[model samples]
Target: MASSTKPPPVEALKPITSVSASPPRLLPTALSLPPKWLNMYSSFITANQSSVTQIESALRSLTYIIPGRFRDAELASESLHSSIQLLSMYHDTLLTRAISKLPGMPNASLHNRYTKFWIAKSKFYRRIATMLTMIQYTELLWEMMAKRKGERVRWRIIVILELVKAVCRLCLLRITNSRPLVTPALPERETIPEEEAPTEEEEVEMEEEVTPRVKEYKMKRTGLSLPTLPNPSDISSYLLSKVLTADDIKAPNTLLNKVNGSAQLAEILHIIQPVIYAIAMSRSKDKKDWQPWLLGLSIEYAARQLRKDGLRTTALEREQWGKRGWAMGWWAMRGAFYENVTKGFLQSTSERLPSLVSGVLDDYKYLWDEYYFSTSSN
Candidate 1:
């Protein structure tokens, strides 16, 4: 006779709140804040919900914690560090570890759970993207403040900034990059095959190994430049850290084993276009074509993705993005961030930058006009 024994008891998942029992030891200072802000964050942390509700609460609190102009460098830095630490913990526990254990298709209930989990994960990534952008702005603010104050800032700020960069790495690592808005987690090319399908285990394993990492920074230094002539690497590092550090450029692609399609890479270039232009204008005589190469290689990859997924078929994809118009806004935002940063930094660059950037802005507006009208009429 067949056995009637039940399967082993399933273990309960750990609470998301419990995942980060303590703040990071390396944080510049403990995450203390003014009484009011501390109270707000305390309430957010104690809440029992495990979904986007907590995310919303944290966002609201974060807005207040990050001051309008970043005064009280120590306090602001601590608050930002604390807030990101909590957000990162929430990401690791609720989305990365817990939700992934749910069953996939076969069972309707479990399948729905998995689908919802993915949606939640995607939303969380969007939030992280905003926070990531804000962190870059914080770095900018620090530089501006130091310049205005005419004194070197504290070393504590450096500790905090480095930690925040680490946080960027962590956020990128834990999230999915199969689409845009969700930055690509790695920097390698991807290829998908029509035949010899991967097993579920294999797919899971591959996704876990996902990486299209951002490694574009030229130096490790930060804040106002010293009076001494800075090295070339310093300039590259300063430029990259001012806005984005390859987050938008990084994509994890499976089609043809690459993450960036040409448009997607173009999207990255477009975002970094300002930086490339700045670097080029600063060193116009250096004729190396990596920036264009970056765009060209991505173009080739995009073609491969298109040919593999659409070219052989009768149905053409209407999406202009790397995948089904998924990352369109995010890709656009990368360009926007570059524009915003470049425009601001112009005060320190070539005197003509202001006019040049304004012209670029006009061209951007015109280019997007067609996209806007076309999409709206559709």
Candidate 2:
């Protein structure tokens, strides 16, 4: 006891009550990982990639098939037409098939990109094809017979524009499938009794009020006979008619009489009405929407085709001054649409967005500067 007392006092350990230890830190629970959608995405990319390669090949084949020199002397007219059309059909079928293989909406943004690429690329081909056949290009024009140094027995670049028409309809189809609830049900028609029908005098007077004779072309299709997807002619007459707008439809035809193409106005509706309806349906509940911008692009595409110096436009374009009013209207819509696209593209992070925006503007440059401006008043 004495020895223990004599020993130097070591520092005493803290009492259990005084000693404090921190609680052990917990490592976060391992997060569950999301499923990789690699396989599905791979299929989509592969389909598009293969299609691109095929398009390139088709272009090359056409270059070979179409003689480099516009040899009116050597080539037979019937044979040349046969070759051009046959090759065209082959290429068209391939492209359509390729486009059809594209994966749909699961990764819709990507799907839209490829589909849009096909549309633009198809247009580029049209420009080239048209250039080949125009009067301006001395090299591209071949003789139909000895006397005529005309372009080949051509339907406008029927192949490419047909593809565009397909895409427009496809877009409309998508809009329909979007199933927006905005479309109002058809209002029930109030049928007048036979006794209450308009008098012969009134009917005669009403008929007399009509000034210009309009030949109406009603486009009809059979549902039972409807071909498999990417049908040749969904918007068959898009290139044939002017782009219809919301304002055009809302106003009574009496007011629209000033425009020459009033008879064809329904054609405009047939083409654009479905598109507008689709846009309304496809837009999200959120305030921000791109439907108008999308429509602007459509307006530009349709109107540009109308003005193009190619087969499609060449066939449809007439010298009538009245027909021009619709072109001007399309221009206004295009300007508005371009503004929206410009804004959206500026804000977009996607790599392809800028190019698509610029590509459209670049292709249409001569349109605004040389064509539209020259046409517009000072």
Candidate 3:
């Protein structure tokens, strides 16, 4: 009886449309705008990185100007500074990735190997550097929380954070094999647009030019092709070649030679200076104790002098060191020096200055009085 029932005619049978067969529902404008805006912002940052950096720098400078006249002003300034730092970190991350994808110089030289190694190493170190920066920006917030608990807790937190930073730096030093650590950890790569990249024709021409020179070099050599010689095809051995060692891969040297042991000691001193200060502050009964200042300043000054003697720093390095020296002036706002000398000097100076200038000084003085770390330039 069932067989006798004829199958439904093909024309009568309608195809069943599953729910998924329908086109995807468009996201609401409000829901979609955030991602779109974020993409646009990211693109803008990528395109005009230098300008963005300048803006960030300017904002940071403004934070310094926006004195801690009241609790609200101090909070605002700190928030602004931290936001800028975070934004810079984000931009730097994007730039790092962009630089990573860029093609190496279109030449068969040791430079290609060096670029490859540096990019990879820089990627690893950049993460550590970013972590250190994160710790720095969040320090105030952490201290604020710890202060609610106890003074000792706050100081301990500082010590711990500083120790972590020092340990991370030590790790970086080891990674560099005692070489000078670059500030950003990521080396700056020249941004080459697609049009700027070498064309196939150019690459062919380069190969032609390079081949003859290499052949001539081989011909000039008196000895047999030694097994000890690096195979150009082997990346590890190629990088380890006399012309391009691991040290060269890690960072550039302004001078011809590698940094001496004293330079390494200087780096160590720089890394541990904050930790020494934190420990001293934690142990000291007097906030204006001279011992902490003496220890911290002595170590810092020695480090600076040793750095100068041991290595020929680049202009940028010298500038950074100079900033550290300027920061040392902050010590006058702390310790017995501040109590005995700087406080009275500032008071007298303010009295003689114009009202506006005196007001500004008073604001800064209040900040210095209220916060232990307010004078920290970094």
Candidate 4:
């Protein structure tokens, strides 16, 4: 029988009440605030306390609901549902208000007061994706316990179909609502800036004056300064650590296989279209040529695999999820945790950080191993 259950009512969920957009700056010990100002600050907190409580409750509800559908699923398990619930709730209540009302927020900053909350939606999608993975696990367990012939297969197909629909809506909602708004672009190059073009006479004169000797020397020196193509090692461990590692690190081997399957791989690829574009663009001096290659490679890989495996193909079908995985990977490399980027031990926290993180993770691991060995000897 088909699963009659609907996808969770993501849209129907109530929003948290807005909080004060501008929080007061910390008072210096010597500069006592006037009695009236102190009273006003106290009153603001008191008024918003109830609203904060409600947002927390809502997030708690979301976390509770995640595993409730599966009789076997545990509420306290090491899954992303907990992180999503806590983070989203905090974001929806505290961060959202600040972003909407706070003045002097840094522009184009992802972690600035305006941008931090955007991570909430993306994190929500990650949890939802993880929960869908658990659903697959439950189905497999059901199949193993099935005594009647064909019972497992019928139910598995039904559950898989439902999951497909739920995932589609989940992705649509996430992209639409994401903070910093994840926008997808079709494969195309932007037109060159008009000002970059020079007159024919000027171009000819410049070409003649710029001797082959100077050109060769410039090229040689520039090559040394330019960065090399990124290898896997180039990705900092600190960057990787940003990917919210759920308490549930123990994905069943079966789940891992499913994740790596052709269908699943394709799905992830489609969801991460933005990241794919970014990666390809980052690689090239010109954005136009590389983007087409990136898009084409993902599409072709999925299409060919689908054809080879004879997976169902239809007009309504979206490519299976390697796109989302790519996005997740990018986030793992670039996203931050609770640590604010505004302050650091030394240097503006916003500065180029990937290399710094890479060095730290490398040294830390070696140090840890040395400590373990010394302790064991004692």
Q: Pick the TM-score winner.
A: 3
As for lDDT, the candidate ahead, 1 or 3, is 3
Local accuracy of candidate 1 as per-residue lDDT tens digits, 1-378: 998997665443655676666866655444544666755654444333343445655764654443333334534543464556545544334333332354441222222332233445577755655455555435534543444444234223433544554455355434535222222221111111124689999999988996765444444467444444346768977665446323223222221222345534533433333233333323333323345334423543454354334442211122223443443333322223323553345435544557756554444343232121111100
Worst 10 residues of 2 by lDDT: 180-189
For candidate 1, the 10 contiguous residues with the lowest summed lDDT are 369-378
Between candidates 2 and 3, the TM-score winner: 3
Q: What is the Cα-based lDDT of residue 219 in candidate 2?
A: 44
- Give a tens-digit lDDT track for model 4, residues 318-374: 222333334333221221211123113223432456865644443333322211111
RMSD to the native, candidate 2? 29.1
- Could you tell me every candidate's TM-score relative to the true structure? 0.28, 0.19, 0.62, 0.22
Q: Candidate 3 has what TM-score? A: 0.62
TM-score of 1: 0.28
Q: What are the Cα lDDT values of the candidates?
A: 0.40, 0.36, 0.67, 0.37
Q: In model 4, where is the ten-residue run with the lowest total lDDT?
A: 369-378
Give the winner by lDDT. 3
Candidate 2: regions farther than 4 A off: 1-85, 94-378
lDDT by residue (tens digit), candidate 2, 224-244: 443333325756665345465
Q: What is the lDDT of candidate 1?
A: 0.40
Off by more than 4 A, model 3 = 1-38, 46-62, 95-119, 184-260, 305-327
